[model samples]
Structure formats: C-alpha cells, structure tokens
Target: MSWLGVQNLGSRKFTCGHCGNIVASSAGYTRNGSNQRIYICSHCGQPTHFDVNYQYPDIAPGNDVQHLPEDIEGLYKEARNCVAASSYTGSVLISRKLLMNIAVREGAEEGKPFIYYVTYLADKGYVPPNGRGWVDHIRKKGNEATHEIASMSKSDAEELIAFLEMLMKFIYEFPNKIPC
Candidate 1:
C-alpha cells in the first residue's frame, strides 16, 4: 500500500535486504509484469528485489560501519567444511589446529611459514597476538590425533566449533586486522 517504490528519495533511499545498505537504482525500473523493483546498491551489487508497494521513509545515510555478517556466515560455512574434512583427521580438534596454523602461519618465526600471513598484518600494525591460548591445547591434541596417538571425539569437534565462533567474531569485527 506504499508508493515509495522509488529507490532514491532525494535525501532517503531504500535499504538493501541482502547487505542492509541504502539502494539507488542504476538505470533500474519497475516492471509491469511483476511490479517488483529490481536494482543494485551503489556500493555492493547484491541484486535487491522487493515488492513495489513497500514504502520507505526519510532515512539518513548509514554511519559507514564495517559489516561482516556475510563474512561470519561464510566463516560458519568454512568451519563446517573444515570440521567435515578434518573429522577423520582430528574431529573438532581441526578448529583448534586451524587457529594455531593461522597464528603460526602469520608469524611467530619459531614456527614455520605461519609468519607470512602474520607479517602482513604486523606491518599493518594489527597483529596483537591476542587470544592465542586455544592454540596450545588444540595443537597438542591435534598432533596426537594426527600421529595416531589418539582420535578426536565428537565432543572435541563441537568444542572446536564453539571456539571457532569466537574467532569468527574476531574476524568479523576486525577483518583486515585478523587476516582470516
């Protein structure tokens, strides 16, 4: 029941449902067949489609806060994939192992190529070496599991996922600093 199908309202614009950004039509129009408006955001091209009747009020520009909801979603998928792939290798321990590898791979030359990733962030002044406690225990278990000393259990995998959720949040909040 709203005729505010227009994307840009001079000082206002429609917010994208996909990325939550104000959308402005880039040569887009309302179709007669469906009457749905189709357009892309001036920032992210996340094809926004919505009912033409939807009304939007005068809204101000976003504060430009960095958003990582999609990134977290991706990490969740990646964590699931990592869990699935490493289940046989170390189960939930894989999450811990990945964290350690991420750290070691970033820097801590006492390790190995881990410094490559860490150096980039270090140079950017974002590598704080914080919250790395999970590495020690997980690495210990992972090493044992990999060498056939023991096998990681389902509980271990679940714990790893929980741990990963924290890491994912870190990356979401400070993506450039975290370096995946």
Candidate 2:
C-alpha cells in the first residue's frame, strides 16, 4: 500500500497514521527488491507501512468541511472514518443521508422524499452551475449503494466525499469568507 514519506532511507518525515501527525521516523526498513517500507513513528512509536503498490488503509481523516451544521459535520467525519476502517459501503450510505441533511439545513422541508431534497438544492440555486452532474452522481450512487447487493470500492467512497467537500465549501465556506 501507499505510505506517505520520502523514498530514501534513514530518518524520514511522514504522516504518522496513529497520531495523525507529520513526524520523523526513528527507524524504517524496506526489504531487498521490495518497494514496501515500514517506518516507526518517533512521535507515537507506532508503525506506518508504505508500499508502491495498492492503497490499503486510508488513515488520514477526510478534508475538513468548514461551516457545516454540527450534526452534518459529525456525519461527514463518520463517513471519513468508514474509509479508514475499510467500510466503503457504510461511507456511501452515510453520504446519502448527508445529502438530505444538507438540504434540510438549507431550509428544505423535512420528511419529503429524498429526491425532493436534491431537487430543492438545485432549484434554489445552491448547486453550482454545471455542477448538477456531481449532485446527480451522488444521488445515483447512493441509490445503487442502497438497492444493489454490492460493496462500494474505496474509489467510490472517496469520489463522493470529495464532491461533498466542494458542495459544502461552496455553500458554507465561501459565503462565510466574504465580508458581511
């Protein structure tokens, strides 16, 4: 799996998966002819392994979503934790609820159908111009995640999370940045 750090030996500064800090490694090793290396964190004494192959553990928390309502913020963090725990489907399902929650927080009537929230966002000019496709993709994937008997891939979960970040920033962050 991919690990964050320089490719050289000796002390390397990498993100410690345990402490979530970028710290120097006290020690590390890579086998001969193997692109994988395991480094011990100086900060936490825990080991973080990096491979030039697949990405296994997504240890990093998802990007912060600024200005979200407290409950929605919690859901966003939970979805991120699902990825760290390798629970892709859970992340996707949570994103579905988040889509609705964001709408309700924006003043859409509660208890309406799921599609109503999505449409409400669009009709109210919340979804950015030409950004309807991203919203639709989240909707379609959320539906598939619910109806289909399949697990979501890491990519699927990550893509949706990225979209949510953008949508939230557009709605909450950017506006808050402007001088009132």
Candidate 3:
C-alpha cells in the first residue's frame, strides 16, 4: 500500500512442491488478507501454493551413482526421488532395500534377517567396524518405515540419505575409482 500502490504483486517464480518443477505462480488474496501464490506445473500440472513472502524450498537430488550397478542405482535413485517428493517414509524403505542389495552384492547370505545383512557386512570387513552402528541406525529407521509404525521426518530422511551415499561410495564408487 506504500509506493507500489498494489498490496499484492501478480506473479512470481516458484518450484512446485508436488512435482518439483519451476514455474510462474499467480497471486491471490486470501480471506484473511494474506497473499497466497499458486502455480501449476507445466509438465505435471500440480498446483503448488506459497505465501507471498514464502521462499521456495530447495530440492535435494541426492548423490551421483553412475558407476554403481544398474539395480543398485535404480533403488538409490528411487530413494532420492522420494526425498525430493517429501515422501520420507518411502525414502527410508527404499534406502533400507538398497542396503540389503548392497549386502547381497557383497556376498552376504540371501534370505537372512535384515540385521544379518548388516552384521555380515561388518564381520566380513565389507564395512568398517564403526560403520556397523550407522548401518544399524539405518536398519532401525527402515524397520519403522517397513512396519508403518511411524513416519520419518525430512531431516531424518536427509541424514539417512547422506549416510547411504557415503556407504555406497565406500562400497562401490571409491573402490572402482582407485587405480588397481
């Protein structure tokens, strides 16, 4: 109402929370006099909303695993995509599955309990002694996710993704990069 004359500006750029695409959003005033910005994704057509002063949340695309095997890379990408979509539970589940895949690929016995896979990785020297604790933490969260006991928060999901990225790099990427 000052120099601009209009209380709300018309349109602004924002990333769609539903579809994760950047697009222009039109502004409208809510009944409470707050300005709400809305945008529809061009590709997915998902309507996203934001307050006038709200900043778009940064989307984390997760880690690069081009060197990983196809199955492992697919699972990792799915987990990352879940994070980007705010589906923390899905991310956790996929991450847990990814860990099992890693264990199997590293010669752990198939059809064993989740803890066996984790312990096998530690006992066989695939993962460091300290890494067992981190793996167990992931396993516990993954259990919560699988059993639907509780949902995961974004921060927890992000932390899990970070840990998985480090583990995958240690198990797959780093070794392949080293000169034999």
Candidate 4:
C-alpha cells in the first residue's frame, strides 16, 4: 500500500468542554456509520462523540492521494526549477500547479477561486495585495501562451518567470499561508 496521506495526530489540543482537563485528541474517520475512537480523560470516562468535521484522516493506504505539505512544496519547486527545457506550456502548467497547491495548502474551500487564496495570503502580509491581481492576470496570459503555440514569445516567458520567481519566494518564506 502507498502512503495516501498523513495528518497531525492529536492536532487539535482543545480543553474538554465537560471536564476542565486538557483534552488530548486523536482524529480519525468514521467507519460503518459509527464514529470510531476511544477518548478517555483522567476524570471523565470514554467520550466517543467524534464529530464528522473534527475527525481528520490518517495516512490511509491508497493511490491518487497526497499529503498537502509535500505536494505543495514539490509543485513550487517544479515551477521554479523548470529551465529553458520546458516549453511555455510546461511553464504555464507548473505555475498553475503551484497556485493550486497554494490554494489547498491555505485550506481554501473547494470550488473557491484560486485568486481568493492569493488575495488571502496577500492580506496576511505574505504578499502585496495589489500584486495578486497582476499575478493572476499573467497566469491567464501564460495559459493562453501555452495554448497558442505561436503566441508564446521570449517577452512572455520573461514575464512568466518574474511572476514565478515572486511566487516561489512567497512559498518558501510563508509556506503555512499558501495552499497545497
């Protein structure tokens, strides 16, 4: 079995709403319509009310799944590492991949626009807010350049590189803010 994913075990260290003791939590998915867990506090007995949303999945055995951190970092590196060997299309794909990763890493909701994540990061001082619009615009242009073979020019490549470089810097410095 391959490594499907991994999450912070006991990631949420919240105080027990019942007993005042610090609750050590372990997150897991439900099986057979029943929440599966054994939460035993020193004072309170086994509290097995593992809510659906609160339960985080462990590294299950499967394919087509990936841990967010590694995936995000990998995509960012790929975008930055691509040299002249990559066609404009490849560069565009790499850039989009990085943006998508950033969205996921930032925990952006599904179906959320990628620009929202960019703007969120910018708001948090990770990136300049005004720059997100420009970067996103260029990302679209890069996509067009990739699609139209004759449209890609050295000037386009240079512009894409500038955006990519800025993106890479943000990812490296503010990894926690970007999505995977």
Full-model lDDT for every candidate: 0.48, 0.82, 0.74, 0.50
Q: Per-residue lDDT tens digits of candidate 1, residues 38-70? A: 555566665555466443221211122244455
Better of 2 and 3 by lDDT: 2
Score every model by TM-score.
0.37, 0.78, 0.71, 0.44
Displacement of the residue 95 alpha carbon in candidate 2, Å:
1.0
Model 2, residue 72: C-alpha shift (Å): 1.5
What's the C-alpha lDDT at position 137 in model 1? 48
Cα displacement (Å) at residue 27, model 2: 4.5
Candidate 4 lDDT trough over 10 residues, lowest sum: 56-65
lDDT of 2: 0.82
Q: What's the C-alpha lDDT at position 49 in model 2?
A: 70
Q: Tens-digit lDDT track for model 4 on 54-135?
A: 4211111111113336776565444433423334455556666566566556665656665665666666554555676756
At residue 117, what lDDT does model 3 achieve?
Answer: 89
Between candidates 3 and 4, name the one with more favorable lDDT: 3
Per-residue lDDT of candidate 3, residues 1-180 (tens digit) = 212222244566766655666776553333345455444455576655455655333365555864788999889878887877678889888889999999998888799999998888888887765888889999999998878767898877888888888888887888898788
How far is 155's C-alpha from truth in model 1 (Å)?
0.7
Cα deviation at 103, candidate 4, in Å, is 2.0
How would you order the candidates by lDDT, starting with the best?
2, 3, 4, 1
- C-alpha RMSD (angstroms) for model 3: 6.0
Question: Which runs in model 1 stand beyond 4 Å of their true positions?
Answer: 1-79, 82-90, 104-132, 174-180
Candidate 1: deviation at residue 100, Å? Answer: 4.2
Error of 4 at 60 (Å): 36
After superposition, the stretches of candidate 4 with alpha carbons farther than 4 Å from their true spots are 1-69, 113-125, 146-151, 174-180
